[model samples]
Target: MGASLLPFQVVDYFKPGIFPLMFLTGPLLYLYVGSLTIEDFQLKPIHLLHLIPFMLVAIHRSTIQVVPISSSPDLVENPQYLFNKVYYTLLIISAFSYWFLGLQLIIKHRKKMPLYFSNYTGKNSLNWLIFVLSLFLIVFLASFFSFFVNNILGLAPVSYTTLPLNLTVFTFIMVYFGINQSAIYSREKVHSKLRHQQLSPEESLPKSGGALLSDEQIAALSALVKNYLTDKKPYRNPDYNLQMMADDLAISRHKLSHVINSGQKKNFYKFINQFRVEEAKAMLADPSFNHYSVLGIATECGFNAKTSFNRIFKEETGLTPTEFKQTLERSTN
Candidate 1:
């Protein structure tokens, strides 16, 4: 999409072959996000259907003779111009549809992460990917509006074109995202085992006691989780997640999630953070750890970052880590 203006904006490198690629922007964005968020994502025959539009347009363009775009293009009389007008309109509709679906995937991903990860970093939460998707959506909207108003409806003079500007913005956004994506993903090897999420269920536990599992089973698993978390202190690992605990407990993710959500009435994230906060409070009151700063204490207490530790600490204690520490000091005085 960023390079779609090459034919019109650059006469010397004029090749509108990328014109058909507008049809692909939505699918590509949707799929790219899906791959990152969906644990079991894979290419299937049904997904190939998305490529048909691009293929048909590419094939059609091969047989047609497109007029050269000069300093000012007036291809209104050309069949290619009419065809492009129609497809670009479809592109707007198709792209928006896919963008909305892709946005939903991201939304689902955001909601799902807390169910697993204790602290959300760039790699674990895919925030950078979501940021890139937002920019792409914005740039596409601007580019479509510019093309529709200026070229299709002829509402403005040739000098009043935003296509070049939009294309340039989109290009830079893609390049920047591409460069950083590798580094972010590389920081933590995205183990597919960890992303073993069933987005369909969102892994929500049954609302009632008599919903799915037997009471005896829930009770047994609840005991197991309490013992594992308290005795072993797995929550101390900031990178801890649902799958890791599940694997350790020799249970399914669903069963472990049910034990935490249904039996204990806490989501995995809160259940774990509660432990960390308690550990922080214990350390804050202990003179043995006075040499440690608040952030240092947060690290010892299993929080990966200070900001999150501070936020969650306050959420639990009604005071920041530093404030809580000062309260302890004053109480002793």
Candidate 2:
């Protein structure tokens, strides 16, 4: 919409009333990212304030375009030039500001993933969002630089030509990620609330004189975690996580995370999914379980999604589930 207002003869038929619609991009992008990270995110009445700048810009442009001016040929030839300069400047600032905010939100969401989720694969990891926001910041910076060079310096008008291409690339990137990226918090709502309830004031307090675990204690806790998983098969529970394991072991979530990170040298998801992949392999290889399909075996082995099962299976073992099953069949035959 903002592009249509550029000083191009082909877009002359395009009206200039809604030129400020470009301002919506920043707030809308922020809102979209917020909705993805925050479960049940609602539009508060306060959020309507974001649209005020757009409304003011739109009103100014509408008045300028409608009001007759006899003296200035600049106004007659290109009335939108001044507006475009201001709009593009604001656009760049808005884009960068919101992109930074979105990036921070994704970082926070990623840090919180281990607290609420078992499998941090795919959408739950939020790497896609980070990448998108990073790319958006880069594009916005380029746009701002281009606008500054063309409109302010007046050295090379061709610099402004790249703005449309930059926007097009941005659009394609957003659409591609939008279609492929799954929801980060789709399955984490209940767990998130539960985790909030589990938090204690002591946990948040500074440990002034709290005893630190010795190396031996860490090793023992790691061994116990491994043994518990092997004997009890808690990984077979789809909802199993560090917090759940900590509760079962009668330890704090922080200690369990420390043991997994320092002793096991893996995150909670990797450690748990490793066991799940092993279980899936065993299920796939067993002739007695031949009645189960690949997805059935995945579900039976505590994988919520077949894609995750396949991805993790391949990551752990070089072969996919089907290939592993085929190899097993050949060896048996």
Candidate 3:
């Protein structure tokens, strides 16, 4: 009885231009379901929050049609009022979830790049945030807010007002798609950056020599490297070479070179590369870092070129960067 009594306009609601697009929503289910399934296998959140829109769209369309019909010929007496309430509550929950997810993604990326920030201070960051926020607002806010405002405060409801509700939903869809496109673009950028880091030699090299370090020297060198890597301030005006490193360590160049050569059993290039490679390795260990390419990792690690990174990595670790990555993945899995 309930199925028959359900407003028949459900089918008519999707007409002509809108029907095809509405039909595509089914396939979109694949994307969300597939991603969630993979996340499950990895012991990650299923992110059902993102999938709520599909359910909400169905609810919105049905409610829009049924509420009017319930007043007319097809009046099923005492039709569950709680049905719409439940659907609306779910929509609100999903909207909040998406907002938090969006903010989390932006925050994570900003921390990765010193130049990247989340606040409104910089034009770029502000613009990006605004664009993203606009997407959410258009997609999930306006229509819902309008509904509440009309019901509570005598403001006009989008569903009944001059505004076309479908148009609002379409605008939201476009904004959502834009966010997806931007995410893809950002992923590519991070990939390139990681590849560049992998090839940089200075990142891989140790301060002097040996795998082990004295507590005091380790503390100082760690601080120096951390500051250097994080701040990225200018290199000094001098040679900017081994002599500089030796001077920084407050040791003679000969002693520094000897320690690097004999103790670490590596030349300057290889030693520096060790630091770079290790750092790259740490970054790669993170699932979020998967967007970065091997080439980007090389450059970020202080390798001047792909060729050098590969050669030195193989010589020092007895495995190529790709091989190392594969090995790491396998072990972790």
Candidate 4:
């Protein structure tokens, strides 16, 4: 609809009132990233407020079509020129703002991931999102510049012809990812705090008033955490996370994070996955577990997805699961 409106004069007979759609891109982007990052995010009545700009633009365009306030003398001299200018300007602003917001959401989501899952799987990771939004930022900037050149500067509007093509490319990219990318979270998984706990500001602070613990204290905590993992094998649970570990040890989540990040010099996920990887290696080496396939061993070692299991295992051991199993068999012979 929006692409069809680019050659406005040629399509005038079609009555394509799609200028309002420009306002929709931003809000939809903001909501898409929000849904990915925020577990509890849901569409509310308040979210409708984001569409107000589109509604007003639609009304203005409809009014111009219904009432001929001035004769059509090219696009500039027409009485509806002011409305067109406002719509394009707002479209640029809206795209830039939403793209910026989406980038921030992705950054926060990346930072938050290490605290929860041991492996950043395709389903939950935002690499595709980051790529899509970065492209959106580029397209939005190009569109903004094009609008400035054509409308504000009274230029030849060469860029206007390319706008629809750029949008087509963007749409194709989005469709490809939408079809290939897995869901970030299922409905049941979204509400599951077992993986990620939404902590309050106060809850994220340490008991030591945000002061750094002594080296000895940190080392002791690290040792305690390691011993706990060895004895209890919490990583055996696919849903295990920092919050669960903290609760099991009667410590705060922040303190556990500190111990893992500062003391062990690793994020919570890597620290936990180290144990899981070791367990997988043992199971792969054991002749008794020969009945278990590579994926079966991964599942037994607390991995929910075979792809993530293979990736993380290779990352930690510099060998794929099958190759590692082959080496084990060779050594036994």
Candidate 5:
């Protein structure tokens, strides 16, 4: 809609009645630029450094319009030509950023492989990185060549005229593929961390392997936690702390912490909330609870607010309450 309404023609971009529409680009620019800046904080220095030129190009596009000189036979004015030249230059620079980062990632990953199976690098990180780098290069070439051919022949006066600047189809496709590749690498990183998690392998044994608790002790602690969840008791009591659970379990705070951390593989608060989330999930799936809002279900589960409840629920089940309920309905149907 916006592309048709605001064509690549410089006159249409800055039309008499279109100033308001053009002005609306300010907030939109702020959104993209602000998000990119925030992302720079989380990204590696090399990745963020590469993205700087792209950010600058986005800013320039957001600010300036390259109008053609009508009276000149060549349709070249000094200022307009300079703007077009700089615009394409910035775009090419930004493409180089992606190319460099992609190559660096590939090289770094390749160096990490074992020499014996280096031939299998094709099945590992190198293959994934190369595929992503190739995809981005294709997008970069397509956009740059498309813009170059259109502008050099005067088919499109503005640098953005050949390709829809606001839409950034190539950038979007490149980012989508990059993120997919990153996700695979990030999961590998997580699994690698998890593999070497414990300092003492002996202590990593399951509670079931040894009598960490007498049957009586286990039953008492389980009953207390179960009742607290079933009763929907608020955790807001000023004195409600780990000490309270320890006292109830008739164990020292240190021992109880070990039991929760080592046995259950979670902190006391998280262990407790896992039970609450289970309660909430049952309620959400029950047809009887269908009339209740999400907030009501969250409160019934002893959560302080719907926000926290929904976040944790999604983390646990990979689905929101609404999504889970929809799945339940679909399965039953």
Candidate 6:
């Protein structure tokens, strides 16, 4: 990006073969997102394979810059021109492909988050990164079109300033979010914790658990979970999560997630939020709770944030918590 910001004469003099380094754009992005969003991410020899494209293209461009190994006078008939055309097209395809794959990684990782996380937080949500990627993709597409017009068609006007301008805006956005966005997982702590707790692409089933749950076992575990939730009302705790409930129930987190998903027909987050919403509904109607404000009622009902509580409440009942309370008030008056 810095290279593109400089004057052509300066860039060519100082960094002639920087075009080939463009191949690194996609690989580096995918590597960054993958490390954050996925489990078991580590520096491995296999990861170096992503660099091969960059290395090959860089070497080819460097040879041509120094030695001018091949050249043709005819514009269309030139082999070098044809290969360069294919090169630019492939660079665009490669970068876009990695961007799309990074999007998929974020999505898949997010779906699994609700299985363990009962409430949303920055750490649990990558929607901001998704927004970032969408902007990057748009900028990238625009820049590619600009490249095709100015350099490929030998037209001078459109592509000259737009490419750098797009990069400059995108750089600012990346910096802004990079500074503001919280880390999804700390590598040192999360890697070790994931290995112990085991939240991978694989199903959240048991490893040491041996045999799969029989229908009878599933029913028994399901009953146990339901009975405990009803009797103890652990869902009333604002910070409660699958792990906490799992520990209280003397079940592994994996088995707890599996039971809730299979038996209750909801992810852990939705399953717990359902209970909280029901509790809020009861309190909304009960005169004894009328003294509490909606947020106070929500806090007592296990919601850490009023926004989450209201959203979840509306999802469960067609009315917001305030609206629900007003409905009860109107009926009484």
lDDT of each: 0.71, 0.70, 0.46, 0.72, 0.50, 0.71
Better structure of 1 and 6 per TM-score? 1
The sequence of per-residue lDDT tens digits that candidate 1 reaches over residues 210-316 is 54676767886687677667777777877788877876655677777877888989888999999999989999899999999988988887898999999998899
lDDT of 4: 0.72
Q: What TM-score does model 2 achieve against the real structure?
A: 0.57
Model 2: lowest-lDDT 10 consecutive positions: 66-75
lDDT at 130, model 2: 77
For 165-270, candidate 5 gives per-residue lDDT tens digits of 4235544654564454322122111111112222332233234445476454455455544554346343332123454444343444555656555556666666
TM-score of each: 0.80, 0.57, 0.35, 0.64, 0.34, 0.74
* Tens-digit lDDT track of model 2 for 207-287: 535466567677777877787788778777776666566666666777778778899898887888888899988888788
Ranking by TM-score: 1, 6, 4, 2, 3, 5
Locate the minimum summed-lDDT window of 10 residues in model 1. Answer: 194-203
Q: Across residues 254-298, which tens digit of lDDT does each residue of candidate 3 receive? A: 455554555545555445555666666676677787888877776
Whose lDDT is higher: candidate 3's or candidate 6's? 6
How does residue 161 of candidate 4 score in lDDT? 43
Give me candidate 3's TM-score against the actual structure. 0.35
What's the lDDT for residue 269 in model 4?
Answer: 85
What is the clash tally of candidate 5? 0
* Ten-residue region with minimum lDDT total, candidate 6: 189-198
* Stretches > 4 Å off in candidate 1: 1-16, 68-80, 159-172, 175-211
Which stretches in model 4 have alpha-carbon errors above 4 Å? 2-21, 38-77, 131-224, 237-239, 247-250, 304-311, 318-323, 330-333
- Candidate 5 colliding pairs: none
Residue-by-residue lDDT tens digits, candidate 6, 1-333: 565544553324533356566687788878878877876688789989999888877666655633111223234555455546556777878889999999989888887788877777764577778888998888778878777665456456332446556656766876777777655543332211112232322233234355556555567678877877876787887656776776566566677788788888999999999988988999989999879998999989888899999999999999999998898899989
Backbone clashes under 3 angstroms, per model: 0, 0, 39, 0, 0, 0
- lDDT for model 3 comes to 0.46
lDDT of model 4 at position 280: 97
